[model samples]
Target: MIKNLLLSLIFLTVLSIAVQAQEALFGAQQIISPEVHDDASVTFRLLAPKAQSVQITGDFLPTVKMETPRGTFDGPGKADLTKDDKGVWTYKSEVLKPELYNYSFIIDGFTTTDPNNPFLIRDVASATNIFIVGGGHADLFKVNDVPHGSVTRRWYDSPGLGMDRRITIYTPPGYENSKDSYPVLYLLHGAGGDEEAWINLGRTSQILDNLIAEGKAKPMIVVMPNGNVIQDGAPGEGSKGFYKPQFMVAKTMDGTYEANFKDIISFVESNYRVKADKSNRAIAGLSMGGYHSLHISNNYPNMFDYVGLFSAAIMPREDATGKIYDNFDGKLKAEMDNGYKLYWIAIGKTDFLYDANKEFRAKLDAMNMPYEYVESEGGHTWRNWRVYLTEFAPKLFNQ
Candidate 1:
């Protein structure tokens, strides 16, 4: 009995020490960096007594113009944070919209994520803290009280690429339980992104789950493949061990990916219970993925009935080769003659590729090709891409 009491005391002492250590590491007081107010305004806080200057950069703020080799486009805005006597820096915004936003803290010229905010998303190599201001469009992006879908990281052999590659597939709710076959949407990622891009930063699964549960979108399978042909998968996911991801990867826009896309389709149709016909098939993507969607749909001519280009790169690179990149007029004409359910194109007003898209549209007009165009406010951003998906998915397989 004495030994038992002694052991109990020791356990209590160890628990107390652990609690004290945790308190010392993360402070005794809880710090809520992002406090959303009733009026839709958000306030951010950070505790760093030794720091001289602190600034917050987020998508909610007005965009700043950035000049690049491509063209001038808008980038995220930054604001200064006021420090109190207690060494806590705080910044309050006027009013934020009901959409998801990502932000980072800049301390003494170095950029860092908010320690207080646990929710984070990684795009390429950079990681940012993300939060959704509920009650509007972001509602679909949230994981609400709805029937969730299954996201699987599957691998398949690519005979064209000559390597086993990774793919992310989203099977809708009631998919596994029921033997009902569903339509498939071949959703591709942008240049720097891999198969994991749409699942993570794009919030594809959450959006699909909420939309499908609400009956806003039909239950369908979404297949996201890595556009970069050189790599088997996303960074650290392939043979490479945790290598830094870059904004540019090799063989993204080349004809290689478009030529080998059949392998992905074959894998999906064979593995999953899908309606393996053109009328029940849809293909869409953003930027380079968009370019691929355009070319792939045209090349196949009878594969996808619905095609979407969200801020797509309109043309191939100057030095790009391959028959897939050749005879664009002939390919598009063949696709138009074959007929499709919907040809949709969406782009931001200030997007650098806006003019190129306009030119592409004019070419379509010359051929009398029918296509739907949607122009939103922001330039080359995930916010616009998510919005596009919400709008695009509903129109698929409806006809």
Candidate 2:
């Protein structure tokens, strides 16, 4: 009886090993969906044998004018994929520039991300597969052989907002071992983004790690706080259960975030080893967050010595009312008088807020406020914002 039991156990173990080997071999045979070639061209593959059609859409492709219920705007251009005998669909694009790009596949008229590709990026509610073309401008966004920084998601009490808020903070490499207190950069995200926006979509940690490793940027602490006033955190992260994220949320552009901005500073100063003075402090953001940074820095003129606005919405909403928005011209003049180290403004020429930025620059010019300006090619996009950040970060605290 003992001999028979041993034989049965041996047979089961051999069967398990054979099954594992077969699974591994099958997994290895799967197609590589996003294959970045040496010439910066990309080949995307999808296995949908039974589907009638396969289409791909991404930012890399030329955009076509799309009509929506609200209005008409440029949307991602779509292209059909060619199918092979094995039921695999494939599409190869011309040479693409060095930047992070996201694409989605449409199988039988249903839009979805690539199943073969594991890397994905979530912008608000929509999620898509992403790939990187390694080369010039995108090199900083890629993680190279460098000492990495630490990113922490911590909760802090916001007495003004009357909630416990979540914040994303990045400490430079060797921060744990070193006893040095570093300067702080309060980096805000655009509308529809939360604390994780900069870290995930913006590639803040990777950029900082690469920049710091190259000695181009200083070793400073970065603090990303949720700019939305009503929400405690990102969608599904707060008390509210998993809910779909929207592009626009209430109290986004209101002065509440700016008014309560001090709470974030207080929390960071109290908890982290950072230089709490104005000279060692900097503030910057994109889109609506840029609007927030502008007002926050102007209202509290003594708080930050460096300010940046990237594709910022320079106009206040008509119904938006608060003390922070009350005396904008006066506050700006006061900010000018106080003298900041670097007041940097950058926007793409084709951005929707270009005119608003132009008007704001005119106001700054009228007041003779010293600020550096940069104009790039593109609309309001993460690509432009990432470039702005890459250029803006090196100029901070240099004086």
Candidate 3:
């Protein structure tokens, strides 16, 4: 009986090993991914013979905001993928419109970046691979045969924060050669965004380059500053720069960023030969940065000639934690009295923040404030933010 039991156990162990070996086989699991065809359709391939299923999720996918009791959000579905005989999964998208789009691969039930794609971008907690659909309005964000500008990572000391902070600066093509002082645009990023956000995710440099080359927008200096109140600089400046836990603990929504706005202006003014009048200085931001721009322009009503809010996220009056002006309407009126150029507010029709923006627009109307309102055709994604910047840039300092 003991001999028979031993033989049976050996047979079972061998069967298990055979099954494991079969499962571990990866026949066709790696290949060239995301090949764009001449007709503007895209084919994506991934090798995962062992995986049971895969799918693709991206902003390029058709977005239909389905209404739910909880709230509204992007599409409830993703593009399904198919597997080939080589164990490689593949997908082909219909001819996409020309625009920068973000996407990721969903293997089984887990979402991940494409291993074969080298270009990727991270916004706060989410990361995805990026691809540009060409030859349409997307041309504005593409690198054309234009005189490109230079982007520099620089630092400045903030007396209010009591530390040196980092900022991304963009100098137009002829900035170095000419002695003429240029107008300055103070661009801010959203929550979970840093100085690099405007440059990396927003593609500000590329947009500026293409716009300036086409003569649709004037050449200027763009100062992209970090809006995080607690951190001294972006992730690479300090010794523990990569330590992101600090970001969560750091309190920014308060009046800290706005109160310290003068420091940034002072640094840029003192260093660069920028046109020093209100007309030459413009401020704009998206989301949290929009909140900052609104507050800063209000607080310093005479500092900037133009203010832009791209899907601005506004908190209810009662929930405002920090020093919001007692009378925002009065403040905005005062700024307009000082001869403002543009008060541009843009938000997508399907944006989650649409209600907040609409309420604010109503307030602006009630106050008889002069502003430009653009209701576009998308959601609260960066795609809208980029479009806002493109539209807003040309209208800046043109007066």
**Evaluated with TM-score, which candidate comes out highest?**
1
Every candidate's CA RMSD: 3.1, 3.2, 7.3
Q: Note the residue pairs that clash in candidate 3.
A: 29-47
Query: Least lDDT summed over 10 consecutive residues: which range in candidate 2?
Result: 66-75
Off-target runs (Cα >4 Å) in candidate 3 are 1-30, 64-71, 244-249, 317-321
**Ranking of predictions according to TM-score:** 1, 2, 3
Model 3: per-residue Cα lDDT over 186-247, one tens digit each: 99988788888899999999999999998999999999998886776766565455655332
Q: Write the per-residue lDDT of candidate 2 for residues 1-399, one digit (tens) a residue.
A: 999999999999999999999987676468888999999999999888799999999999998777777355567899999999998999999999999999999988999999888899888899999899988879999989999999999999999999999999999999999999999999999988999899999999999999988889999999999998889889988877699998878888878899999999999999988988999999999998899999999999999999999999897697478778988899899999998899999998878799999999999999999999999998888888988989999988889
- Candidate 3, lDDT over the whole model: 0.85
Candidate whose lDDT is highest: 1
By lDDT rank, best first, the candidates go 1, 2, 3
For each candidate in the order shown, give its overall lDDT on alpha carbons.
0.92, 0.91, 0.85
